[model samples]
Structures are given as C-alpha cells and as structure tokens.
Target: PPDVEQLGRATWTFLHTAAAYYPERPTPNQRANMLNLLHSLPTLYPCSHCASHLGDNLKEHPPDVSGKAALSHWLCQRHNDVNERLGKERFDCTKTDERWKDGPSD
Candidate 1:
C-alpha cells in the first residue's frame, strides 16, 4: 500500500515521542525467575517508556535501552534518573512496598 509506509513512519514517531517522559525508565527481572514463572510471570516492576527495566541496574556499564523516547530516565543519562523516579511516592507509593514481599527467602 502506498499510504502504508507513510502511516508506519507516523506511528513510529508518535510512539517514540510519547515514551520520552515515561516514569519507569528501567525495570528488574531475574531471568531465572522469569523461567521459573513461565506459566505466570508477575510483571511487578517499573519499566521505562521504552519497556526497559525502570532501575534494574543489572549491568556493569550502561544497560540495554530501546531506541524509544520513554528511555529518557535521566538527563540524557539512564540509571541515575530512573532510580530517583522509583524512590518517589508514585510507582511503589510506599503503601504498596510495605506489603509487597511476604514469606521467607532461600
């Protein structure tokens, strides 16, 4: 379709721009844990607009970030800004974390 290409480009631009101010820029998810919960994975983490972990910090240097606008966690940075957002009283909202984790650990 002739219009298909133009439409696709426009859609991409809209999506990219919207992600620019996403709150959760990064998230944390254990691969092993994901595997274990293959049947029922709990998406219990913040993610950047680009769908990256809000503040997983599961890397040595910078981390995997989609070329999306939501990836804007910091001032052209990543982890630092995302961390601050997570600490705010919005995502976790304190009221949620206080009762998030239950039972014991191994």
Candidate 2:
C-alpha cells in the first residue's frame, strides 16, 4: 500500500496539472465537472486521515471555480494548508502558473 506521503504527492501532482490545463474561461459544464471532482476528493481519496482533513478544510474554505486563476489559487491555498500541517514551507501562490504550467525563465 502507498504511504501517505506518496499518495499526497501523486494527488497533488494530478490536481495541480489538471488545474494548470483547465480552461481559462470554462463553460458551465466544465465548471460543474471541476466542482464535482473537487467535492468528490474528500470522500473518494484513499487516505482516510488526509481525506478527513481535506473535508474539514473544504467546509471552512469552499472551492472557487469561477475561473482558471481562481481555481489555481484556491488549490495553492489548499496545498499550503497541508504543507503547514506537515511543517513544510508554503509555496508561492503567485508563481502557481509558472510552476504548474510554464517553466521558469532561465
């Protein structure tokens, strides 16, 4: 079985990559689908402890799927929340697009 760290890394990679590629101006259906995916994570995620924490966080800070930037920022905040719990450094939310989508300039 995968450990929590492995599961978390894989999950975050998938989420950030997906958010990176999400339409800048998603259609109604796309927004709905993204919302569904986000909402399902807490319940469907394999790590029970992680899932519970995410569920609690979701209640406190509901997702913002208004647009690509909004969604990406929201995910970054959520990732920071997890990092805080793990005593990890917080990622710079401002660099989300560069980190997730575009490579940093040399």
Candidate 3:
C-alpha cells in the first residue's frame, strides 16, 4: 500500500456540507470553528485542485467569518477549490479521513 503520510489534509467546504442536510443555521461554535480552520492556515501541502500549494491572491480573502466572530473558515488549497467549484463543478475523494488515526505530534 502507499505510504499514507504522503497524503494531505482534509479540505472540506462546510458550507456545502452543511447546506446539504442542514438548511437551518449552524451552532455558533460550529460556524466559528469552520471559519477559523479556513482562515488562519498559512500553507497547504496538497492543493485542492491538484498537487500544488495554495496561491497568494487566493489566500488574501478573509473567510466570511465576520461580525465579531471568534473563528474563520480557513481552507488549504484543496478545500478552497472545492468550495469555489461548487454549483459550477465538484471533486470527490475515494479515501477516508485517515490523518486522525495517527497520534498527535510534538
């Protein structure tokens, strides 16, 4: 099997994910957490569209976590692309979320 560490992080666009089964508003914490994860991150190892890092201008926009919010919807290149492609196009993953299986690092 391929050395899984070669794989990248999860780039989930919570908006579409949430919109699917939940038209209702999300909890404050949930929304905040999503926003933070999407905003603060610096570099993405694996790009959302392909195997590339996130671009600069792409990184400029602050996630839509405004109005005295505590967190932002930060995304690595991969997840950001998905979020943008939605309605126009989309990508699917054959792999499951495997990173969590590994213990935390120092």
Candidate 4:
C-alpha cells in the first residue's frame, strides 16, 4: 500500500499529465467526462483529510475544463494552494508546462 504522500504525488502526476494532453476544444461529452473524473477524486481519494480538503477547494474554485491550458493552470493553482497549506514552497505556475509536459532544460 502506498503512503499518503506517495499516493498524492502519483495522483497529481496523473492529473497534470492528463490535463496536458486534454483537447484544446473538447467536445461536450469529453468535457463532461473530464469534469466527472476530477469531481470524483474528492469523494474517492483514500486519504480522508486530503479528500475533505479537496472537496472544500473544489467548492471554492470549481474545475475549469474549458480546455487544456485552462485546466492545467487551474490545477497548478490548486496544487500551489495545497503546497502552501503543507508549509512547502509554492511552485511556479508559469513553469507548469515544462514541469509536466516538457522535460525541464538541464
């Protein structure tokens, strides 16, 4: 069984990568599916505290599934919020593409 931190990292990676590949102009069904996938996380995530916090965040700032860029930016902001709550340094949202989609230039 994965620990909470490991699970969180895996979940975020999956979400960010998925968002990175999401269509620029998704069909209505595609949009609905993506929305469902995201909205289900808070209820289905194994960690109770994480789930509750995500649920509250979702209520405060609903998912923006309009397109890939919008979704990625939204998720980055959400991740930054979680980082702040955990007393971690906030990530630069501007570098989300390099971090998630494109490998950073070494």
Report how far off residue 57 is in candidate 4 (Å). 0.3
Looking at model 4, residue 30 earns an lDDT score of 92
**Which is the winner by TM-score between candidate 1 and candidate 4?**
4
List of clashing residue pairs for candidate 2: none
Work out the TM-score per prediction.
Answer: 0.23, 0.94, 0.31, 0.94
Write model 1 residue lDDT over 8-106, tens digit each, in one string. 345333423333423243334432332233212114222224234422333323332432232432213432344465573223322221222232312
> Which wins on lDDT, candidate 1 or candidate 4?
4
Q: In model 3, which runs have C-alpha deviations exceeding 4 angstroms?
A: 1-24, 43-55, 65-106
* Winner by lDDT: 4
What RMSD, rounded to one decimal, does every model reach?
15.6, 2.1, 10.5, 1.8
Q: After superposition, how far is residue 55 of candidate 2 from its true place, in Å?
A: 0.2
Between prediction 3 and prediction 4, which has the larger TM-score? 4
Give one digit per residue, the lDDT tens place, for model 3 in 39-98: 444443344443223344345545543322111222233454644644434333221112
Tell me how candidate 1 scores on lDDT: 0.32
The list of candidate 1 runs beyond 4 A from truth reads: 25-106
The per-residue C-alpha lDDT of model 1 at residue 38 equals 22
Quick one: RMSD of model 4? 1.8
Q: How would you order the candidates by lDDT, starting with the best?
A: 4, 2, 3, 1
Worst 10 residues of 2 by lDDT: 97-106
TM-score of 4: 0.94
Q: Local error of candidate 3 at 39, Å? A: 2.3
